[model samples]
Target: MNTSELDLRELLSFKPRGGAISFLGQRMYLTDLFSHGLQQMELCRTLGPEITQSIIVRAGFSKGWLVAERIKRQMPDAWAEARKGKLGPLLCSMYGFGEVLSSQRRDGIQATPLVETYFISLYEAEQHLRMHGLSNVPVCWEQIGFASGYVSNLEGRTVYFIEDECQAKGDSYCHLRGNYLEKWGAEITPYLPVYSGICNETVAAQLADVLRSDEALPRNMQDKINLSLKLTSIEDGYPVSNSYAMRSLLEMAINVAKVPTSVLITGESGVGKEKLVQYIHKNSPRSDKPLVAINCGALNETLLENELFGHVRGAFTGADCSKSGLIEAADGGTLFLDEVAELSPATQVKLLRVLQEKEVRRLGDTETNHVDVRIISATNKSLEAAVEAGEFRQDLYYRLKVIELNIPPLRERTEDILPLSRYFLMKFNQELGKNHTGFHYKTADLLLSHNWPGNVRELVNAIERAVVLSAGPQIMPEDLPHEIRDTLCLPSVAGDIRALHEVEKDYILAVLEKLDNNKTQAAEKLGMSLATLYRKLKEYGALQIAICSWLYSIAAILPGV
Candidate 1:
């Protein structure tokens, strides 16, 4: 696998049979080109560019480490001495990061390669063209982090790569600078925010100092609720879910957990569908056994088949050793397939067989093995819609949906938002050693009012960011992420230019009518007391009927009218 022996064709080639591309023992799946860009755009708009960049950089850094490890194992001698300079071009080719026109060692440090076709640069350039200057920085944090991570492991030192210029920032060509961190000292401090999970020690210390000046207050009601819910949340590894809808869902999950039926958990991404699956797994009879989870969407069909069902040593190219699949690992437990809707039709047919027979046949294996395992699959997409479109198998959909649980989105469960926020705030405060008590009133109002498109995941990220940035005891609106803070705190019906009293009357009447004039049910839905509902109804001249109905119920119960 050394540079001289590396076959470029073997490194990256499309498989005619599977329509999948192989890269470094991994499968490359394809999607709409603009889909990823659009997602990044939305993340930046919601979490702000800096936070999103940090997230992307962290992801790239992890990926780079994995690739570095793979290359080292495959080419031990080539990795031992860094002279080959072939790994960069190989990675660039595989990842569409551009060609390394030239790379050299300089003063015992590796020089940043002159990339001729930087993928991220072109992506950002097109994004800016479409958005007309939506980005302000290099917009290449992931690429920079990837280069730094790969080189740092290869060189056996802490290396850093900085995007010195980017086409997104109006530069003609995206250029980068690289060196060991010790060689650059504070020179690279400006780029720290783009890197994820690296807190500046000085800033954290300053925050700790400020916290010491604040009073150690007793736990209030909200604090108590947060503390209790946070403890349970941590215990179960679930997010804070205190709303009626979530509670009912949990109750149903608990009841269904007693059975060995296949379960399908559906929700938008980041609503913690996996967490609910875990909750069910823990409460089930198979709690003591392994709970294996695989993301069907992350792997292409070839790799996915090899992973889920495993293979013999001669299964395919690079299958040097016999491997057991996740199904075997979860023989007596549960297997959760995240993004199960993304399973290729071929894989779906094979999975359907497993569900029907409770047995798995490994690739290139002559025999099938019986396994006792529960299947709990989750997906963000509508599996029914996919099935209707013939993208997903109808039988598999019905098999997985024997017991379905649709977790409500965060907007519908607004009561949980504040508790969840405070829980995350407290959780991060402990992690960061901050004494932040709670959100400011305005900040709380903003959180309550804004629609969290990303749901609990987004809220958690916002709290973590606020925790990291807050310099005071309270998290102010300024400390929140821009999307939340920038929201206009107008009335709910901002477009309806009606008087406040009239609006209230209309809303109350609508609720009562929706409930068939059942004042108790209307009061419960409105989050008000029966007396309050009666008073509002009386003021609106709609109480007499409700009063007569109540009297009629009492008279009937007493056998007198």
Candidate 2:
């Protein structure tokens, strides 16, 4: 069949029971586009870009070569059409690689025809852009290899396709030019090893061996991979811990869970006080019982009273029926009062009475009901400060803080950043149907560097947003929220204010380091002249003798000197 007559849909088939899918009578299965990107990312990360490119190119060559052979065997007429430079682009487009915008051949130029093909919306380039951002060179390695393989098989001579322009490098489109290897000469030497070296099978086997043996990887990388797996395996709805502080806090929580005394959790807002409460409740003596929770700050005085101590029928104008309060509903379980500091003085008295008497008296009801419930109060504000200010009762503060547990803010537990990020990545991946493998290295750096002013809740929102925006196998820095991506990696001088000169010296050195010690660039960025920067560095005793000598020579040549 001619290329124009081929029907792509008719050549593929699948069974409803899901045994196997067939494409052109060959067994095939669909794969997520991001899966290939993930493999590329991991291979590049572990093996370096050069080797990974070679492997991917060779694999694509093998695939294209096999497909050419299949076409020759199944339809000899189509093979003739392919030899005319008509079928390759059609096949490529039909297989969903991309749309070939144009294809042209000049047969009279040489013994072998010279072919030029321009493709838009190439999946390879899109994948590269998504995974690694813009690259410095052409990144459509597989597409080049495929074209070379297909053309070489058809012409019975070695042919090479060089991608002169690629979208991966921020080009408008990918442009491939193909000709005999001898015609390109030295231009193709760098890629010759990819085609002439060990066969694709050997490379595949070696890669498989390397991947199967954890000993082959560096120790730190192995640890990172193991940590990732461990994070992924954690059960959902449980608090994730990586920092020693958080782990120790969890141990404390578990120890305190066995006790039935009232516990107060203290932390900044969004520091996961509720999660700590859930952890305590799950591990407590009343594990099978209900865990009722309420945000006292969400309700005013009367509503808070009604919610805390259920109102009987005709208790108020809106109270048409009697309803159980959170304390009564949490009988034989735990009651979590979030933002307990927001409770009014009257509600605090009633809650203090409930704690002291172990009985809750519903509104407008004479008889009280005895309830057995553990009180777990949480407040972002300092109850001590509030009690001192007379805004809160001292007795109620002491009653709620029988055994206080304080959770450190996320910034203080920096080690938990990646673990929590991975946890949320896995969570949102499942929730959003994404296949993101992990964060890009730069993205991880940004996440670690962020102050996390909003704590874990901010991190959760960031990860969920990244998962929604990321188009690659890994999350990139651009996918992160702007505030996070823009977080400066400055040395924190939170409490101790240093002298102005010391701060200036640190900032200058930091800029120099960030620019890889390029003093000129650092000076430009620091908004100072080279001589001025040199003088500052010399004053700080930071200039090496070689730099000092160079500066002296430059000074000698200047008019001012």
Candidate 3:
């Protein structure tokens, strides 16, 4: 069988190499999209990951038309359907068509109403639109961004009037609120009294001028209120998380500020468990003291003890000179013991003695040294289980775990995933001198869908690799390592089996498109509450094009079916 040609035998037994070779099966442009967002495809131009980068470059080097043609052959239904719209949702929806353990409430096995159309993906809708063969970028594209301004009372109600003017043409709409309001009609009359009240052309013009006042609104907002928005200013910033878990962790750290109690941080490695420990120390009385970290797993009993406590002159063969230990080094600060579960029984005793006696003894020194050090130990495993199995000392466990700060794993705390991914992305982007702005929605969804077993550490490595291989302004899916492709994509692999909302909001929006933005109508049709529909749409991230897609989908499908 020729390597390029498909052969049954090779496809059957092929065990893709875990590093970058597993991506041998992925489509080229989709892969590059990942690489672009990841910044790895760009890195490949300088220092490439040949196995993965080569496939993406070789595949995407051609224009998209050819790629679309090939996609057409392999996935004809996708092509035929996309021909009716665009292939984007067909592709982009796959990013979230996986097993993601989100905080979204799942209502099991609801029957779909044959009378209603659901939100399909924008990419999918685009594919169906593209099937029409108008593939060139439109002469002009417009975006109507909908964002809520800071809480402000409008008219009589303390209501937030949704800003749906074009981000690029905000200024154009500065003179046209009446026109926009009239376009929406009586439905919005209660929200904006100006729209409900009768006004002449002159009066309407004055209102537009007032709303678009140069002295009042920012220059950027005034300039593009009418034109659809450009890509979000999400323009390549570090992602930061502000969720309850992080808040709880910060609160816990603050609560332990006055005491010198030992803090044992338990969580999967690379989940910022160490950082959480640092936060605790900084908030503690020992904020000014140095934080000395020792990885117990990397050292044995003797070395671990020596590292933890100082040694006297000639205590061990390598002890040529007397020196202060980590505990002494962190005299006024905190001592962070990483991988505490890996400590030996003998080391545990020494550590326990430090806690109980408030002093540590050097290996060879006859005198015991008293030091003021806050002990903060972290482990990737459960200390309780370790103590029960006699792998760890129970007394030591109890001492170190006085304040157990359990850092929730990345999977458990889903909210932090994107921000953390962007944090690593931005860091790698700058350090590597690449201009990768951000991950596309599809790739972002992929990142969110992944069950990060390796936690933040694995995400960091993936971003670093993407930065190393990135080609342009964004990181795309293909730039990810084979481990991500093979392991993390486990959720997407069971695509059709995923719940309605779990498939990401992109697809949900596409389904909503079948309904034309009517929440009440769509809800009545979907057999869910209007509130539930709105909440789910936002939660699934389907709100962006959900209403429009629903309109377009209904126009297309309702006519046909």
Pick by lDDT: which candidate is best? 2
Candidate 1 TM-score, C-alpha based = 0.48
After superposition, candidate 3 runs with Cα above 4 Å error: 1-239, 486-561
Q: Compute the lDDT for candidate 3.
A: 0.51
Displacement of the residue 141 alpha carbon in candidate 3, Å: 18
Between prediction 2 and prediction 3, the one with superior TM-score is 2
By summed lDDT, the worst window of 10 consecutive residues in model 1 runs over 218-227
Where does candidate 2 clash, by residue pair? none
Q: lDDT-based ranking, best first? A: 2, 1, 3
Candidate 2 achieves a global lDDT of 0.76
CA RMSD per model (angstroms): 28.4, 21.3, 20.7
Q: Give the whole-model CA lDDT for all candidates, comma-separated.
A: 0.70, 0.76, 0.51
Clashing pairs in 1: none
Model 1 C-alpha lDDT per residue in residues 1-561, reported as the tens digit of each score: 234334333244343334454455444666543777788889989999778888877666656655675565333434444434556656755576654445554554333332223333445455555666744667776677777767666665656677766778777666666676666667678876666433223223433333222212211211100112232462355566767799889889989989889999999988989889999999899999999999998999999998899998887888889899999999999999999999998999989989999999999888899989899999989999998998999999999999999988998887787778877887887888876666654466578668999998999899999989976555767788889876644334322244677546656765664465787898998899999988887786556645555555577679545
TM-scores for the candidates: 0.48, 0.52, 0.50
Q: Candidate 2 lDDT, tens digit per residue, 57-117?
A: 7777766666775675444435656656778988888677889999987762575438899
Worst 10 residues of 2 by lDDT: 218-227
